[model samples]
Target: MEGVSFPPLSRFAVCCGTHGNEMTGVYMYRHLQKQKVENITVTTILSNPRAVDACKRYIDIDLNRCFTNALLCTAITDSSPYELRRAQEIDAEVGPKGSDEAVDLLCDLHNTTSNMGLCVMYNSSDCVAMHIFKHLKSKITSVPVRAICSDEPISEGYALDSVGKHGLSLEVGPQPNGVVRADNFNVITEAFNHIIEWLQQFNSGATFEGGVEDVYKMTEKVDYPRDLNTNEITAAVHPQLQDNDFKLLRTGDPIFLSFDGETLRHKGRELYPFFVNECAYYEKKVAFILGEKVTVAFPSISVTKN
Candidate 1:
């Protein structure tokens, strides 16, 4: 494939605290506020101040899910949800989504209760995000680095990062809500440093050699078994499957254990599971998500000199 060139990424945004209780990003956003970089404008935002202040996942709705074009274009009113209003404000600052004035790159930070370590999530069509994922995977040796691709267009993406011309979510995990684990925090910090280094190199006209990468493409969400009468969860993630993100689940593999001491087995074709037993996903009715591992090829890319 021929090399692809993109205009120099001059503006960047690092957004965190979209979930409020995800402490790694909240603190990282604070740390980044005091730092400066050369050649690029780095705008750091604490995405949801009120939610962060309360240490809650969100004020009214999940801010991470409020950036779809429809939501961003919605007319704000007194009855609008707090997060909806904040999403519009954020779009005005770093986005205006799908416009030329949007930031060159936007990276949103998040933490998960599941044991997915140092994962980058982005739309599969984003070559820049894919390259950044490859760079971070190659550079960060302290923890496992992986990428999850949502095979969709950026216009349909709902995450905060989707507002930028190129966007990705830097998600690290096994950390609980409202708490900061030192190891997880350090991993995220190192990732940001590497991302900045990559930006500097790309802006300086370095060509990045890209190749095939194995990524997990999100397929479906699995919810916990609920009681019919009370509509309450009746099963929990099996011990064998808990904290085992990225493990393949085959037919007959144990997935859930009912309160009555019955083991529930997987019934479908084999697929890798991620975000296993996530805390926040409980409310979202997602026990975990299943994905298929597939290899994607990206072309070498360089910054287009003006």
Candidate 2:
């Protein structure tokens, strides 16, 4: 497929399909490519083609988890035809000298396995990212929740992390065939369109009302696992407490019991609740610990909107 182009702006980009199985964004991006945009131009990138074809997350490597200046150089220098071609495409948009004079924005689309609703993932450290996130939230209030921190630090070298650029990892649902895929698409499309309009205001030399806030700086990302299995293969979950207010349990408090068609037993030590349901049969992305409350965080927004 050919990359979509429009009237040249300072700079803009939309990258998706980092994971082959997570492809809702890919379909949406392809649809967008069929049309013509104005002022803000976009270059579309499909991170892992082999994985997408295999219906898996990756082929040789998790492309999303492999991003570094050295890696890019290696890919370009090692004479890997595919890597060289991919590098050229990427460099055309955000190369060392290409479009560096302008503000470059990347909107990454992704899907989740856990049953969390639609949410946007972004680095709050960047003001441009914050503005895009806030504007998207305002435009698509029904969906399109808060921006999230990436799982990159744990995965080591992530393309988004090493790029030294601003982007949003837009996670939109439970899975590829998740229930809210359509809603997720709408949220991201509306957000993109709204961003276009918001940027247009600046292009016309109009004063924008909202700016990045200090509160945005207060945002932090901490990863917690909803499912944890000991090396010995012991799996235990916290007991179903009186209410969802189960965070009152201390670290050493007694948790719950797992049965294998045997005697019932309670597990000692108060294990925190990343998620009440931690079954391997189900997808468990992450459990976010909020203020005095521990809920699923991977694909869900930190904030709740009425």
Candidate 3:
């Protein structure tokens, strides 16, 4: 079958299963399909078939990373025997030839390995993006959820980026075993329902604000500091790193005072250890931090406060 369409209305595309191990959305998609939602026509497309089978991030290439125009053309050509068939099936369901009626909305399901609460990854623009997200957050705040900036560096090559080029990315946090998973699933699914209901309610006079601008230009992905390899500490734990403390590392902070591993130093006068990926045991020690602003390895060295 090419596709199973409801009546003729705005398409609310719900894409799930982009990452293999983040299987919460896959189950939620199944649950959503079994139900009877009214108004907006919903189409749930399952990406990353190989990843889902292997239960790995991606098989050959990260499907999320391979959405560039050049790569999309190449991938459609290089499909394997099994993949070729599966690709065809998915195409039938949601290929380029699908409806072009100004697709009003898009939502993707995702889970994180880090137990970092729920958040929606959205393009800085899209007026309704924040509206719906805030609404969902208010409901889940008893559960307590936050919104991750789509322009933030962490969320790069995300399915949200692709769809947000057309729709929006709805990342529903990590699953706290089955209980939190159920709650997340219900809440997010209900959020989707509300989107449709809102669309129908405001169909007559829905006004979309222009893309988000002014503060900082939104980016496709966040830039990560590079060459922090070997034994260099970009930022370090002076004494004790708290929950939401921001540490700015200047010259001479005993980045690698002990000096066990090989250290990485910079060219300009300053020469202190830059520690990025240090040990295997330490989960997210120096890699990431939770605060207002984050420093990225980009054109400039330091990052301003958010």
- Listed in order, each prediction's TM-score against the native is 0.98, 0.63, 0.59
lDDT of each: 0.94, 0.48, 0.45
Q: For every candidate structure, what is the RMSD over all alpha carbons to the true structure, in angstroms?
A: 0.8, 9.6, 10.8
Best by lDDT: 1
Model 2 over residues 52-168: C-alpha lDDT tens digits? 677766555556644544555564545454434454455444543213442356666777653444555555344455555666666776742554443344223345423424556
Q: Write the per-residue lDDT of candidate 1 for residues 1-306, one digit (tens) a residue.
A: 678999998899999999999999999988898887888899999899999999999989999999999999899999999999999999999989999999999999999999999999999999999999999999998889999999887889999999999999988999999999999989988988888899999999999997999999988999999999998999999999998999889999999999999999999999999999999999989999999999999999999978
What are the clash counts of all predictions, listed in order? 0, 4, 12
Q: Where does model 3 exceed 4 Å of error?
A: 1-9, 79-102, 151-161, 164-166, 176-180, 204-286, 289-306
Model 2 steric clash pairs: 121-148, 252-270, 253-269, 253-270
- The top-ranked prediction according to TM-score is 1
Which model is ahead, 2 or 3, in terms of TM-score? 2
Sort all candidates by lDDT, best to worst.
1, 2, 3
What order do you get sorting by TM-score, best first?
Answer: 1, 2, 3
Write the residue-wise lDDT of candidate 3 on 73-92 in tens digits. Answer: 34444454343344344434
